[model samples]
Target: MTDIDLNQILTFVKVVDSGSFTKAAEQLKQPKSRISRRLAALEKALGTQLIYRTTRQMQLTETGKDYYQRCAPLIQDLENANNAMTSHSVELSGVLRLTAPEDYAKMILAPLLEEFLKKHPKIKIELVLSGAYLDLVKESIDVAIRIGTLKDASMKSKRLSSISSIVVASPGFLEKNPAITKPEHLEQVPCLNFNVGQKNRWRLVKDKQDIRIKANGSVEANSPELLYHFALYGRGASLIPEFLCRDALQSGKLVHILKGWTSGAIPVHLLTPAQKDIPAKTKAFMEFASARL
Candidate 1:
């Protein structure tokens, strides 16, 4: 019956995403009343109810859910196209949300962000350092630096680095514990574990032969940084990425064991949403990280 406006659609999406008119208003930098009025206008213009209000929480009606499922992609596409087209001249501005494991964040990403921010002075960044696999679409992440094989088949990825796992232990631990002459010797000493495939297994490869060992340890955690610390403290030997332990291995904090064998090269990736054109901020960060990593 009437033409729907982009502002109304954006406002509705913001409200749904933020979970309340008050919160959405804060994100939009608009008054709560203005946000409510826009959402009300959208419903009136459509001639149907889109949401049910309970005075505390907002729930989308069936129509609203269906509408959001369709409109969100369209809205994202519009913004992405505009960003891609204008990015040539517009000095990248806006908050870039990123996620990565804590070890990478501390050892690699933090410094990169520092240099990137200096060059792109107008851009802001939000970094989430975690080992959890977060949904890019649901979490509104701009891009993520992830290790290992990419799981989300829909997301586009760029290879940032190829890192091989190195077996290591503290010098003190090696002195006190039995010498590791072969892969199976790892079972006798505690093995600080990293989460892989719901089990603790290190598959070492050398000269086309593979040795599989079920890692046993007192300290097992998802974070490579934590495991590195554990090894540094002589808690156990751990199979960690060479990139993560290279500095320590050289500085004598951690000793590399089984030097001839490796856990193979694992590809690190930069992931972005597959549905949209690469926005300037995300593209710039990815490029900066790719070259540096």
Candidate 2:
């Protein structure tokens, strides 16, 4: 009935997801007593017991389960529509929080973000650069730039670009090492490990042949960026992103090796938390980065 409050229904869903009113209060920054009152009121309005409760744990009744499934998506659709309308009328002016890889944050996003911010002077940006995975919803991140495949199908993602990696060494390292005529020659040459991946192994595919090398070197580093510097210093051959190492490869600072081979292209995505409607800034930035990347 119209007397059944929509906010109570939303709070009910959150309570179910958070497992208890106590946890839901913490997540929503609301009072547990208030949540209990609302839930009781919603049940009274519906004239049915929606949940089976004890001091220890709670379970959803058949009516509650059915009601939740039906109302949750309807609430989301309503929220999305409301957000879309509200955001369209206002100029974007707020903080936009984002997380991305260190290499990308420095080499790629930095410049693009500068231009984007200039165009929207009222907007502010907070960026976190790391290789570690973060919870977008828990951390309240506006957007994230993730490499390779995505795991969360619930969150909205936009494919920006494909990042392909290449194996390269400094001109000096190659000159000092063997002729490197084939992929097998890499074993003779020192191959620095990138981020301890695959434990001294390099996977390359070419000619429909899958080549897995027991690759090792004098140095193991945490980032491809670090290994890039090591390779520049003529330490060892390393695999680095092709787009990132473009300048170094062009100026002969780094020379491409193992012709007709690659570690393969990884799909990069712009990710945002699952929302009925995405925020204005997040949508704008995703479009901006997609156009440039």
Candidate 3:
């Protein structure tokens, strides 16, 4: 029996996972020719054709499927062991991919990331900011910061903090429009609606009493940051995160309205994929963010 090359096996697994040699080569930081050569060498050593490749697509053979099913887990275990071993002896260094809401990333995470990077200079970060919940495995995201209820039970989550929502308007807008003395008064004024998850309605709570008001407005947007700006410009009253409006409220640029009523506290969570072993870099960021956020 010929002594098999572990590198060839690793290359084979990479090719299968990536679905093409070109992609696998790019990920491995090797030439396409080298990836092909490795796959050919691996097949020769095994005495079987593992992959059926063409111009458009690549498919695994019967033996290849069985081999991959067995090999993938073993490869993961080896990589995990290597990561675990190296993490203790050396500084954490790897590209950590993270995703979060755009506004939150800019206002909250930007500074924290700067600090995190300063602490771990060797680590590189790839941030994907979007309002949509991206699939972790498909997007290859290492960690995600999310606000509100988590629907996916498959992912592991760590509760960071609870963010309370504030209903606010600018001093100028309040002077020109109807004064909001209670929750019912909100309907009479122009409300800057944040159209995400929920309808054009604002939910307010005060001491066990829950009130739902149908919000009518001239401006509606999916971004809370935009709404915050609109509120500052005295466009309309906006229901936004308190953190986003705290400075404006203090400076008197924005006035907190319906003081006793709140939109309720939304839970913030750090999410990671469900796996046997979490990479040290991902774990480090999660812990770092958990304490600070």
* Predictions: Cα RMSD each: 9.0, 5.9, 8.0
Model 2, range 129-211, lDDT digits (tens) per residue?
A: 87777998898899999987788898888998888788899999987888887888888878889754458888888878878
Error of 2 at 230 (Å): 0.7
Tens digits of lDDT, candidate 3, 1-293: 35578888899999998889999999899999999999899899899999998988899999999989998999988997787787767898989999999988988999999999999999999999987889999999999998889989999999998888889999999999987998899888899999985588889998899989998888899999999999988899989999898888889899998887888989989999998679899978987998898
lDDT of 1 at 53: 90
For model 1, where is the 10-residue window of minimal lDDT?
Answer: 79-88
TM-score of each: 0.69, 0.71, 0.71
Residue 101 deviation, candidate 1, in Å? 1.0
Give lDDT: candidate 2, residue 238: 88
What are the Cα lDDT values of the candidates? 0.86, 0.86, 0.91
| lDDT of prediction 2 | 0.86
Query: Which predicted model would earn the best lDDT?
Result: 3
Candidate 1 wrong stretches, greater than 4 Å:
1-86
What is the TM-score of candidate 1? Answer: 0.69
